[model samples]
Target: MAGSHGGSLKSWLAVIVILAGFTVGGVALCFGPNWPLVWAGAGIIAVGGVIALLVDIFSDVIVDAPRVLASEKVDRKG
Candidate 1:
């Protein structure tokens, strides 16, 4: 059961969110108090977004069409 830390990931996520909020909150509380770490958060979010965009773009290569059998249809009049 050493590696079976069930729900630990959820707990860690909760802690990270809380800490992030507090960090921005503290920045606002000590600084102008209006735009507390907003820029920093936006920048971090943008970085992740850019990576996702690049990955998605790179994976979207042109796909080939499926082959159809010759007997499927025929133009007898032609």
Candidate 2:
């Protein structure tokens, strides 16, 4: 239950890798027009995607049942 809402560590790592790639690409654009670094960033993002697939991150996701609020329950009773 502690980690029910959060995904696995591996999935988190994959997301971090992808975010790092975005940061790299952003830095490249901010400083001069560094096409090579942009490409490198794209590669990093691709690697992250591959890692996510390899770890089967989708399988770790789950749909939780919708909670019934107390107010809603009272309204239904009336």
Candidate 3:
């Protein structure tokens, strides 16, 4: 679905990876403040960030032109 208002599969995958990292970190903290696991989670998040950059996720973004309403039109009568 090119030009659709949604991210590509790769972008979605990266987002999922980042979310998983947050979950892992949260779980580790709730358990016993497991430093090792926490670090691992951070690493996972970093990897996801790298993936996002590599894929140029922002390149897929589409910005619509600004709309001009009829009521906002200026009168040129002098």
Candidate 4:
């Protein structure tokens, strides 16, 4: 998967994590014995958010480096 299209697998996994977090969090918030379940859901969501951010950052860096380097080369040539 990683070799097929760069980091697509990680991105898809992150999305799955985010969706699961939202689903669990919403259900826990709606029906729970105590506040701990809600907090735990929030924590899951937070971790998903972090994973999402990291994936976005990594993808951006991977996508941008070649362009940046190419531009630098053009600048040097021009």
Candidate 5:
């Protein structure tokens, strides 16, 4: 079954960015000043924003590209 995450490249990148942010946050909390909370919060927000941006870009590209769908099997999977 197609659970949740379809495993699109964009989704993977988003996951990577979020994980990186948490890793950085961990380091910051351990060594840096209290600003890590602010930094991490902002970083998470920024990552979410970029993911949205990429979705927009992907949708634009999909729309602009030439394609014809005849059935559910022919639809864009990602």
Candidate 6:
């Protein structure tokens, strides 16, 4: 039976990124004076959250690799 996590290492990395974005965004919203930086952090958090959500939902489809057949190999005459 296939386990829950069918995504690649990159997907996991994305999750990490999302967490970091949320953390940074929260901190910026709490402490940053400038509105632009706050908005940028919020945007980053939103984008990262969406990507992580998609990755988790479609992990299998996202990470599935095509099977290669031995007969598909081309032999070089060199």
Model 6: per-residue Cα lDDT over 4-66, one tens digit each: 334576576666776777777677778856667667777777787787777673544443356
Q: Between 1 and 5, whose TM-score is larger?
A: 5
Tens-place lDDT per residue, model 2, 1-78, is: 343578888998999999999999989988887999999999999999999999998887755777776754434553
Q: Estimate each model's TM-score.
A: 0.35, 0.80, 0.73, 0.54, 0.45, 0.46
User: Residue 61: error of model 6 in Å?
Assistant: 9.6
Q: List clash counts for every candidate, in order.
A: 0, 0, 0, 0, 0, 0
For model 4 the TM-score comes to: 0.54
C-alpha lDDT score of every prediction, in listed order: 0.53, 0.87, 0.86, 0.67, 0.63, 0.67
Ranking by TM-score: 2, 3, 4, 6, 5, 1
lDDT of 3 by residue, 9-33 (tens): 9988888999999999899999999
Q: Residue 69 CA error for candidate 6 (Å)? A: 40
Better of 2 and 6 by TM-score: 2
Candidate achieving the largest TM-score: 2
lDDT of 4 by residue, 1-78 (tens): 322435576677777787787777788777864477767767787887898898783563223232333444334554
Candidate 5 lDDT, 7-66, residue by residue in tens: 566655766776777777776777755685759756885886698577653443222334
Clash pairs of candidate 2? none
> What is the model-wide C-alpha lDDT for candidate 5?
0.63
Worst 10 residues of 2 by lDDT: 69-78
